[model samples]
Target: MSTKLNRIDLNLLVYLDALLRERNVTQAAHQLNLSQPAMSNGLRRLRDLFDDPLLVRTSDGMTPTERALELEPQVREVLMNIEQAVQPRSAFAPEQAQRVFRIMASDYAESTLLPAVLGKLRVQAPGLTLDIMTPSDVSFLDVERGKVDMVINRFDSMPQSFHQIHLWNDSFSCLLSPENPVLADFTLENYLQAKHIWVSKTGMGVGVGVDPDDVQRLGWVDSALARLGKKR
Candidate 1:
């Protein structure tokens, strides 16, 4: 049976697919060559039509709830059938295709993921173009707005209607100078007494203006310091 009926937009399905893959509306907009606001409008439409949040944000990144996950396979099957019926081609010939992609990530993510992804692209899709944006203000909503591409961050709370992917996980660690006399031994007392060049953006609170992970990390460090009678 054709699911294209019922006043349903087949295009929305495509958008939904992209949203699922990219986990951010802005990245999906880049994939669809649409504006961010337009993508958001599409997201709103999907949310209303399906009566599901679809995607939600987390401290790390976006996550797909149960409903969205359950729908994924069926949606992909429908989209694939349509593609096969229309194009009947199986291979992506990058040399002949004009493909452009944008991605948004933090400096840390860029350091980790871009090198590998770009290396793969150079071989598989040499003709395709890539534009990467390092996100600031940690507003992944910009990715949804299509001003940015995919966002790479620690998982956190996200609204449904966007898509998300789990690339990897990260953790925090402390560093010290090799020349420090406290280097006599690595001890809790040494760590406490050592001076720390703390780095934090002072303008934002926990979750409002700053990234949640950053705020959490800062708080964790503060707590850790308090345990040792150290002040930041």
Candidate 2:
């Protein structure tokens, strides 16, 4: 492996990381601002170097092979270490910088917070690009692996290694149909009697349980239910 690394160009590792993350040559090219043909040539070279088809085209999309998956962490770590070694500690000039920031956030944050962020970026960092993705179970992993630059979500406990700040305190509001008869007298009994639909992050299942890590995510609903001596 060391001998193979000695023969390979370091830039190929950057291309490989992008390809693995995007799983599409065109998208990866766009991310790196390289032409599609150039990206294709890079992929071909990477295959020859690795002696494996790192990514395979399928009906769904480009899928990473087992070898590619295994290399992901090491590749990301190498790139991150290199970046940290060379990055200046002085104030960043956002206006002059051409960079992409990847953030994983909840649907609510996407709708509410990201618009404000975009507005600020348009004025302060015209050359910067923002890639916003919906948070999944693997979001924290993404952050830890340097695949995502930031994550916006409520958590019971923040990861010790991460730098964290309280962004804002959010509150929930109940919405009801105007013509509903219960609107006149909204009480705990009426609330309990009303059928509820919950959007679960984990997806639909017969009797699947929620992960303990997800408890803080249900805080608003849980607090209301706790007041009524009930649990969801």
Candidate 3:
């Protein structure tokens, strides 16, 4: 296997992976940012190297051959392992590094955590740039494709493939105007009677003390409320 690998250009494996995923010459070319002719040449080289028509044209689109299907997972794993193995091992010199950091975060994180992160980056990595994006439904896909470097979110569940850290603990608190009547006579009845506002981007009804519906959307807040036998 090592001898055979020695004869192959490692980049072809990357191209092959992209081709198998896309199953279209043009789409694979776009993925690798190569010209159509260049991608065709790569496909030709791959066919010569493997002695297989890895992809066959079908009415719907390009279809992978049985050999290509069998090789997909192995090729992806090999490329991923190689990527990790070759990644920088030396201490990161944020002060000297010139790179762009892409982050996917929520609006709440944008208002809270991003300012602090930007402050630190200004001092530590003057040359570094940040591209902070509001997360979408496909944000995890972006992370998987390497378009997003990190995501700051409060998820109910996370994929096992990701590395995560708990940044801080937070609790929800109700804020009322100082002059509000509730301030003078704050009681459970007053709290229950008071009109409330829920700020949600998705227009979902807000939970009073802890919204059970938010358990899947808002991380641990609901669990904390459950511990106290409270529901809003």
Using TM-score as the measure, the top candidate is 3
Clashes of 3: 2
User: Model 3, range 1-232, lDDT digits (tens) per residue?
Assistant: 7998789999999999889867799999999999999999999999999899999898988988899877876786688889989998889889999999888888888888889888998998889998888766445645655567899878877766678999877767888889889988888668756766656666554464546466545444446655666544
Where does model 1 exceed 4 Å of error?
A: 1-96, 200-232
Task: Provide TM-scores for the models.
Answer: 0.47, 0.55, 0.62
Per-residue alpha-carbon lDDT of model 2 for 4-46, expressed as tens digits? 6688799999999999888899999999999999999999999
lDDT (Cα, tens digit) per residue for candidate 1, span 103-180 = 766677888888998898788778878777655554654544444556676555675645787887667877777888
* Candidate 3 local Cα displacement, residue 163, angstroms: 0.9
What ranges in model 2 sit over 4 Å off?
A: 1-87, 200-220, 223-228
- The CA lDDT of each predicted structure is 0.73, 0.81, 0.79
Stretch of 10 with least lDDT, candidate 1: 138-147
